[model samples]
Target: MVMSRRKTKVNALLSVLISLGILIFINVLNQSFFKRFDLTSDQRHSLRDASVEIVEELEDPVFVRVYLEGEFPADFKRLRNAVKQILDELRAYAGENIQYEFINPSASNDPVKKKEMYTKLSESGLTYTNLTIRTKDGVEEKILFPGALITYRNKEIPLQLLKSTNRVPSPEMMQNSINNLEYNLLSAIHQVTQTRKKKIAWIGGHGEITGLDAYDMVEHLAERYTIFDVNINEKLNALIGYDLIIIAGPKEAISEKDKFIIDQFIMKGGAAMFLVDGLQADMDSLQSQNNMMALASNHNLWDMLFNYGVRLKRDVLMDAACAMIPINVGKFGDQANLKMFPWYFHPTLITTKNHPISANVNPVFTQFLSSLDTVGNDKDIKKTILLETSPLTLRRMAPARINLNTVSIDPGFEKNSIGKTPVAVLLEGKFKSLYANRLTPNIEQDTLIAFQEKALLDTRIMVVGDGEITKNYSNRQTGTVYPLGYDKFLRKIVYGNKDFLANAVDYLLNDERLIKIRAKEIEVRKLNDRKILAKESEIQLANLALPIIIVGVFVFIILIIKRRKFS
Candidate 1:
């Protein structure tokens, strides 16, 4: 027995020593090599190869300042944890070059200090969310900054962490925001690290909004592109070097010469966004006088668009699913009563889901929008309707009068408006020139004005039936314009105009692959609330008794085996 015990001791010591040595060796190897196994069905934990490459090729460090740290609800906590996990994954590839820090801006109790910090963050382009939490005694309000500021080289960019489309927050919205975490982080990094920016021109010879009025639009595009105003001025080579051009809300007519220049540009593989105003309605006149006439604007681009694929009709669209405008209904001193009425003329647009450009976007708000009808039968041209009105939509053709006071009295409005009307479309493939047999620029002196009847390369164009969707409202008091798609009076962002416009520009600029990445959908699984409530008692009993029962059985089995062996 003593000899057997000695052998057992010796064997135990050898096993311990061997295990220690193996652990030391693994530690040494771990310093130089790394590997991670992701067992997720959708590879949610795995970064895309493109993202890994972007990080691995970094010559300098990318610093991310995450502002999601604070005492918040369980949902926000999950979001914060996910952000950390993603950052760690990124750091595994880029090592210490991917640096980050978590900051809780609301940690400070001093009011002045908190305001100062918030002001600075806002100026730096970070946005915050306000939340109200229920406590045992009462409800308390909280402010959460669910965003980040990323800096690489000398460029800095702000990333919004929440994907909110409505005024109220929902669990689905939070999940969608979480699903986009990787893309948002990597895209921001990619934007700052790009050595050369793509050039975009906002064509301006036809009275498009410019300067401060168009600052919001320009600022967003200038983040990833070099944006400048280009007045074609009938110059043959005016749009030669531009990757994309935007003709946003032009009021004046485009001359045939200028149109020919644009057509030739498209022939040579160019892309453009045409924000056309098919029906002109004076909103201010209606607001002041409570009455106005809706008429068609003669910008003279209808024929060109028809030839391409879409017909921007000369009618105003109405929908039951629309926005509300406040009106003073009571007499002058009767407490100044303000009532809200559904404004049918301002239809809220529905975004198409199957297309990447409009996927997962919220309803777009429009003023005096026209319906679209696809006209071309060319097999070479592929047309996709990106935006449309709800099934309850009707068209009021030109020569109809619009009276704001008649909204409450229109009994047949809902019955008449009952069909999905197309408002925006995307045209792709080789385009046949509208000026195929028509005369081109007087090339008597300018040899550069060459005409190709058909597109030499596949091109894309996005046409929206309403121009006001791209225009932002200016503050009369401060002269500062709200961001495009924001409703100042409603004090809410009820539209996805900015998102749609950006996606449209991206699609036109030939970033379909990248846009597809943005359109990736992750299914969020959650326990059904009603089922959980119904089975709450059963679940609690199982949780309390099942583990104890298993443990008791296990102990009884072990005791019996030991007793049998001893016997």
Candidate 2:
């Protein structure tokens, strides 16, 4: 009796310990224990790791307001769900500092007040769209817009609604846009909640694209930057206040005085982008001469680029994989050929293995391209080709005649015969100005600054062989705006040669952390049909006999053990 009592007591003590352990586990899970698991694929959680850092560093609450209404249209349901999923993930990852609210305007049918609020929002430059639906007997519509407005401190930033025409969003395009949003938002929150905006300058003059054309890029970056346009002729030291400067596609030659100003800007550690064209394009002549292409190479800025370790050759590059346009040649008739203009010679540029400037950018487009040569191996200057032509490319010298008939890829062209050609290049490091020792040329005088003796600036510069690739040229005969290639207006707008140029600028400015966003891994899994079939047959046989086999083995083992014990 005493032994049995002692055994029972020991069993009771073990049971109590197990019960206490289970209770503690349940309590921990109810609090914060289960949150440690990263049960998300990379696709669904691109910013998961970064978000944790952001939350930990966050000192204040971020208020997010989303404007959505009852029962969305069938076409918009996918977008709505995607937005909700992203917001939920952000909230979870951001911890207690991220607060969200959903607002439905239709809930309150007061038109006067609703219109007043909408007008205020519209005046603030917030974009919204209406969704219309037609029933059997009547028509019903709802105003659906991006409902989230995030506020850090007293500053408010709105999140625009994302919609795609295709049922499924293009993974590449969607990822680019989302990555842009995450970076912009993080920077905004960081600044508004803490520091001031950084200043940047866009160099005017030399016939570059106006600030109006760059409004979208400017606005996207304005949340964390103060952007302004300055002409080098106006004030040279005016750029001193800015952290970066941008020199867009310049038509006219850059004067030595202006070049001195730019050199000084770089010397002060100000970053700049030089989107130079190798050949000068005359649209009027091309249109008047029946689209006869002419090459214009005489530019005063070639010396500067040469001194900076890049040579823009005076040749037009044509690739067999060109963009097509409808041309009425009057002989082959009005059919599409793999032409060079509307369909640009899109160089499948291989970006540097580890550089932010080329991250996530698809192939870039170039027309009337010039070859770039690296001159004088400067130890401080690092140059890499950001864009290049395929091996099946040929270069045509300028002042050569070109017509629609000369645009097609020759069937006899061989890849091994032609070598790989560089179309665009990225240069980073200290650069010596070409005018370092030379006297300032005769030009209108501004407050001239002395050029730096050593490399003035640690900067990033992108040189493109062609400029016409980014220009939007329309045919006078047809009112249609010709695209470099392909259909779909959004693709034309977002992924065009201009888009590539804009992406280059964004990368240079370092406004968007595009380099950090990982590319989607292509999962390629194939089934072995024969092996699978054999395995299926084996599994079926085992399922049928497993129970019987187990029972027989148990009986044999028991009988053998009993016989041994008796003997």
Candidate 3:
């Protein structure tokens, strides 16, 4: 018996030593090498190759200050946890270069101090959301700013953790926010770490929408790019320093010289976006004047665009899937009865599913948009439809008359729009010069010219048939421009023009891979409410009693083993 007891003690000591040795070995290996395992169905925890590369090349530390801490709802808790996990993952790859801390903006009870902090956060470009909380005493309101600030080197960028999409409740918004966490964090890091800013120019001489009319989009683009108002004015080198040029909704025709300059720019591997209005239709004119007629406007770029592989039709698209405008229907003396009616001329363009620019994007609202058709058999030129009108759409060939009196008259329009009509198109590849074999412009021979009849390098072009897609509405009274894609009367987002335009810009600027990250999808698996309600008692019992039962069984098994050993 004595010999057996001594042998058992020796075995126990050996087992303990072996376990310690194994743990120490694991620690030593982890210090030199790092690996992470993600077994999720969608691999939500995995980082993109671009993200990994950016983090690995970090010469300076990135400090992230997240303001999503403190006691909150379960959904917010999940979001906070997700942010923590992504930061942790970034830190793993970035090593000591990634630093982060969670901050509770409302932690202090002092009102003055709290107000001061709120001002600071707001001044730092953080916005807040008002949330209502209920308790036994009464209902109270709390303001929460679900945002973060990331700093790298001398630059910093603000990230709104909770993206507000079409106004929704916290549960749905939180889930959407969680889905976008990776993209938001990664994009912010990229922006802060980026040392160079690309130059973007808006073509000015072609009578395009300018100043406050294009304020919202211009402001958004200015965040990451240096914007310039450029005019060709028969200058060959007008577009020399520009990485990309946007011909946004030009009202007048482009001159031949200007077209040649643009064509030569494309031939030399420069990118451009043409937000041209194919048909002349104006909502302001309809509202102010009695005669409502739309004439086809030739911006003189049709030949150029056709050569580039797209033909923008001189017609307006009317769709059943459209926005509504309030109409006054009461007598002159009586109280005006305002009723909402569908405006067929303003169709909401459906986003394409496969393309990164349109994937998972909301419908883009367009006014007087024209249909686009691909031209030419150039195998080098590839065209993809990015946005289209829904199947319930019909094209009204210009000179089309728009009457406001038709709002009350229900002339049953058939669903002729059975097929998707392309409105926005992306053209990419080696483009053949439009000016090839055509009369050369009158210029001195000493001028520097690329003179490439075909594309020297692969380039991209985006053709949006409606220029209104880039226009923002301003309050008539205050003269304040509303955000792009926002509808003030309906108090809801009618389209995603801002995101669509931004993505197009990014794609044209040669940030395709980074923009493609916005297409990442995360499936939200929700419990069946009906089933949960039906078996509420059973679920509660299992949750409450199962833990106790497990503990009881474990303790019982331990007691039995002890007794057996003693015996």
Candidate 4:
């Protein structure tokens, strides 16, 4: 018996040493090659390969200051947990290069100091959320900043935490924001560390939109890209240096020479975004009277577009799902009583989910929007519809008469739906130039023009039929520009036009890895409310008594086994 006990003790010691040795060996292997295993069914803990690669190549430290540390509700707590988890994962890959801190803007009790911190954060581009919670002294209000400030070297950028289409901070919105936390972090990191900013040129001199209308987009984009206003003036190589070009709401017709220059630019693998308006309709026309005429105006680029693939129709569209406009419903004591009415002309557009460009975004807003159709069966070019109308849609032909009273007296609104057409599309592939066969011998032979029949590399071009999608409202007197998609009548920003435009540009510039990351969806499981309510008593009894019963049985069995072995 003494020999057997000694042998058992020796075996236990050897087993412990062997386990330690295996652990040390594994640690040495891990130091050389870092790897993480995610056992989650939904891969919630796994980061994308592109994100991992980006984090691994970091040469400098990126410091993140998250301002979500104050006392908040459970949903916000969940968001904070998600942020912490993602940052930890990134740190695992980035090592000492990734540093972070959780800062509570309201940590200070002094009012003046807390207010100063709030101002500083807001000026640095973080949005604040106002919450009302029931305290011991009635209901109290708390302001929380659900955002982060990422600093790389001398550059600091702001990233919102719950960045999604839903304006309301609901539970569903929180989940959506959590699903996108990884993409948001990695994208901000990549932007702050870029050695050179991309170049974007805006085509001018065609009565295009000014900086006032596109202030939100222009100002926001200037941080990541070098924007320039260029007038081609029929020049051959005017747009050769730009990575992307924007043509928003051109009023005048584009000359043939300028069009040819743009064609050759695309043939050389340049990306372009065209926000054009096919109909001449505006709010000013209706202010003079209750009725107005919608006419199709030609910008003289139809032939070139038809050759490319899409035919921008010569009509306007409407939908039962549309935005509201204020109208004079009645008067009281010589005062005009303005009430909100659904303006069919201003359709709230539904985006497609198959493509990452428009996936997981709220409905886009458009005014006096037109439609388009894919014409040819070009196998070389792949056409994807990015935005379309809902099933309850209707159309108005050019010269169709419309009146404000139609909102109330329309016979067929949602019941007799007629239209569901593509309003925005993305065309990707080698594009055959519109001027391929029309160029003269001298023009073709000129080296400056260097016209290629087909595109040198696969490229992308996006066309949206409504220019208002890119235009932001501005106060004429104060010179203040509201955000893009801000509805003047509703006095709020209730649409996702800004997100759609930014995503479109990201896809066009060959940065689709981040977009795919943004498209990841985390499954949200919920309990059955009816079943829980029905089985409440039984569930309570099980939760309160089952653990004690199991522990008693386990203890009794262990005691009995010990007694038998000793006996």
Candidate 5:
């Protein structure tokens, strides 16, 4: 009996040691490698390869402070959970390099402290949401910021978690913001950690947009690029070093010398964005004088553009689906009465879903827009329409007259606007030089014009018929500079112009990592409310009893095992 007892004790001791040894081995293996298994079919919990790469390559720790804690609503809570999960996934790959904290800006009980927190976030470029919560007592209001600040290597970058449409939030919009959680976080990290800034040449000295009118976009672009004001100035190598030239609505003509310079730049694989208005007309003129003529503005590069595979129509594109402008309908008791009317000249360009550049983008609004036609059929080039007018459209050529009375061509007169035209296009391929035969010695940078008839490298060019897409408006009298896509008349109606420009830039630069994340459609599985309501009692009973049953079964199994061992 003593020998039997000694044997049992030895076996038990071995079992304990073996269990501890297995645990230690597991701990060592976990330390050596990190892995996460996501079994969901949609891979909702998984990070993209691009995101993992960014985190894994982190030279320093990336700390994100998310101001989404202490949330009241279910949607906000879901968003908060998603942010944490993404950070956790990143941390799993990056180990200690990825870190995050959920902060509540409104956590302080003191009103002064909370106010200061909000102010700080606002100044740091983070926006807050005005949330209305319906409670048992009554309706309550709350201010919450669906944004975060990512700090990497001592630089803090603001990331907006929710993309505000300047309108009421729809259920789908909330889910979209949730779906893009990974992108928002990693983009901020990538932005701050990036050492080299790509140079962007802002074409100027031809009356292109500047100052507050372009400040918002310029600021946003500067976050991702180093912007320089470049004047072609009839130089052979004026735009030579720039990766991309942003030609934001040059009011004056582009000299052939400068045009040739731009052409050569493209021949060498440089990208250019043309926000040109074929007609020289703006609302500022019509608003003051009540009438103006949209004459054909000469930019003097028509042949060059045609050769490159697009013809910017020298006309005004008017659409029935358009924006509203305050117009003087009639007089009201000694006050010049102003009433809101649909301005068809300012059409909201519909976004095309087929292309990543414009996929899921909101309708872009433009003024005095022109149509584009793909010409020359360059076998190497690919023309994808990014934005176009709705089928209910009317396009009138230059020498077109614009007057306040023209809102009379409102949505009611849809029959006249039965035509559709593409207002923006993305041209990509190896382009043939327009100056193949006309090349001279001075045209070449280092040597005599070594005119290559065909492209030595592939390139891309974005052609938008409306200059207004790149222009931001400011109330000169009040000095209030509105955002690039904010609607002046209707505050709620915001355009997708800024997003369109950002995506276009990314695509042109051949960097679509963030764009790919934005394009990801996360499927939200909604519960069937009717079925839930029908089986409410059963569901509640199951929920209340299932946990107890599970615990009882576990306890019973444990007791049986203990009894067997003792026996």
Candidate 6:
């Protein structure tokens, strides 16, 4: 009996030890396994990982504070959710190095505390909107503002306006805004993480579109790159220093000398983007109220592109879908709903392909667009279509006139025969220069830059047919800027066109890091209403009794085994 009792005790002790060991192992495995699984959707996963990289490289911790007051508007819930999700992701990925906080000024109804918070937010350059709501008696009103402030090493960067809720939300707008957040936040982080800024050059002169006209686009890029506006006319030596050059909408013909300089710059393996207008349109008369239209075959730069297997046609493209504008034909007396036809110039919708540039871009609008014809097939060059017209598009040869007053839609506009046309194309690979054998032009050497070589043979180039499509012309009186094609403000900005431009620049600079960031995917989860309704009672019962039942079953099994052994 003594031996049997001793044996039973030993067995019980061993079983308990084994169970404890199993429990410890399971707990450790669960913690480590959950860490590897990013519960965020694909889009958020990319963003979170990118944020992690930034935070991990931080020599010091950064603090981010979000301030949203009262109950958020229904429409703004998505923005709030996105911000929260990003913040949580950052906090998780940042480990203990980065700290974040959310502040609701309304947490305390005390006026003093609220005022102090408002003052601090204001000092930090955070923007807020006042939400006015009437009281029970309809006399009193209240206001609220929600914003975010990021602080690093005592420096505070406040994001006053998270998003705009006045207009309907668009995917492009949301993506663009999120991208802005990524760019701005990452750039700030990079200041501490990186040792130097990347160099990017904008090629000027040769009647190229002025950088002043591209202020907004350049400003956004300046956040990440060291932007330099180079007039290649003074010297070719300066071109060698820039990692990339942008030929933005050159109107005048490019001289052979300038072409040589550009070619040499490319030959050095420098990337470039050409936003050239196929049929150059002069607004000189239109702005002066003369309503005169002129088409000039001034983009001779195509000579170089032609040698590379890409040709920019001079014909203007028209689309059935276009923008509408109200014009007064008779001075303030008679007004007509004459469609400005801005939208139809062919709105290039974003393609869901794997190309980094067009990914997540909204539809882009183009006006007076020309077709890009591939010339002299070169097996070495790889061409991709970045923008194309709708199937209901037709080619209208230039020297076309735009009369806003008597502008009548062609009754036969839909009948015109033209298949889907390509407006923008991306070319990569080896290229031969048109000025390979030609001597440099002696057109006033005063501003001429010398060439180092024929051209960068292996380089990437993006060519867009219509420059006016991206141009925003505003009336000085109303201060209302007219979008290139569509009247929808959100549509104009979100469309793939702007994203394409930005992405093209990013790609040319070989910044694959940002390209990867653009490929994020959002995971949406919807509630299963039917299952919830059908199994409501069953689910409730399971919730209440399942754990108890499981515990009882285990206890009973243990008791039965013990009793049998004892008996």
Question: Against the true structure, whose TM-score is highest?
Answer: 3
lDDT of 6 at 31: 72
- Over 1-567, each residue of candidate 3 has an lDDT whose tens digit, in order, gives 999999999999999999999999999999878778889988788887777887898898999999998877777788899999989988889989999999999999999999998898998888887777787799977778789988987777888898774333557667878987887788788778778888988898777887888998998888778898888898988999788989988888888888988998888888999998878878879888844888888689888999999998998888888888887777556678887888888888778677888887778888888899998899998889888887777777888888877666653457355467888899999998887777556432325675778898999999989987888887757887878888979764567888788888888988776676777778878899999999999999999999999999999999999999999
- In order, the Cα lDDT scores of the candidates are 0.83, 0.61, 0.84, 0.86, 0.83, 0.65
Position 398, candidate 3: lDDT: 84
Better of 1 and 6 by lDDT: 1
How well does candidate 1 match the true structure in TM-score terms? 0.77
Clashes of each: 0, 7, 2, 0, 1, 19
Off by over 4 Å in 1: 1-80, 91-179, 211-213, 411-418, 440-445, 521-567
Model 6: lowest-lDDT 10 consecutive positions: 443-452
Q: Kindly report which residue stretches of model 5 are placed more than 4 angstroms away from their true locations once superposed.
A: 1-44, 65-82, 101-180, 334-337, 409-419, 441-453, 521-567
lDDT of 4 by residue, 1-567 (tens): 999999999999999999999999999998999878999887899998788888888999999999999799898999999999999999998999999999999999999999999999999999988878888889988898999999999999999988643444877678878988998899889889998888889888887876788888887677567889889898877897899999988888899989988888888999999888778787778768888987776567788778888898888888888998888888967999988888888899877788988987778999889898888998989999999998888887788777888878774856667768899989999999998778789988888667799998999999889866888889879998888877777666678898788888889998787777776667778999999999999999999999999999999999999999999
Give me the candidate number with maximum lDDT. Answer: 4
Q: Write the per-residue lDDT of candidate 5 for residues 1-567, one digit (tens) a residue.
A: 999999999999999999999999999998888677889888888888878778888988988999999956887888888888888888889989988898989999999999999999999999889988889899999999989998888688899888766545666667878887887777778788988777899888888887778887888788778898888898777776789988887788888778878887888889989898889898878989989888987777678878999998889877878888887767999998998887888998778779888987778889899889999767899988888888888878889988887767444445666477888888999999888867555654446444456777888999999876888877889887778888767664378788789888878887687776666556778999999999999999999999999999999999999999999
Q: Estimate each model's TM-score.
A: 0.77, 0.74, 0.85, 0.83, 0.77, 0.73
Report residue 567 deviation for candidate 5 (angstroms): 23
Candidate 2: residue 561 lDDT (0-100): 100
Compared with the true structure, the alpha-carbon lDDT of candidate 5 equals 0.83
User: Candidate 4: lDDT of 400?
Assistant: 72
Give the per-residue lDDT of model 6 (tens digit) for 433-508: 5555554455223344443333435678888887654454455576554432334534343344545677778887
Task: For residues 318-351, write the lDDT of model 1, one tens digit per residue.
Answer: 8887888888888667577778889888888777
Q: What is every candidate's alpha-carbon RMSD to the true fold?
A: 5.5, 7.3, 4.0, 4.2, 5.8, 6.8
lDDT-wise, the better of 2 and 5 is 5
Give the Å error, residue 402, model 6. Answer: 5.2
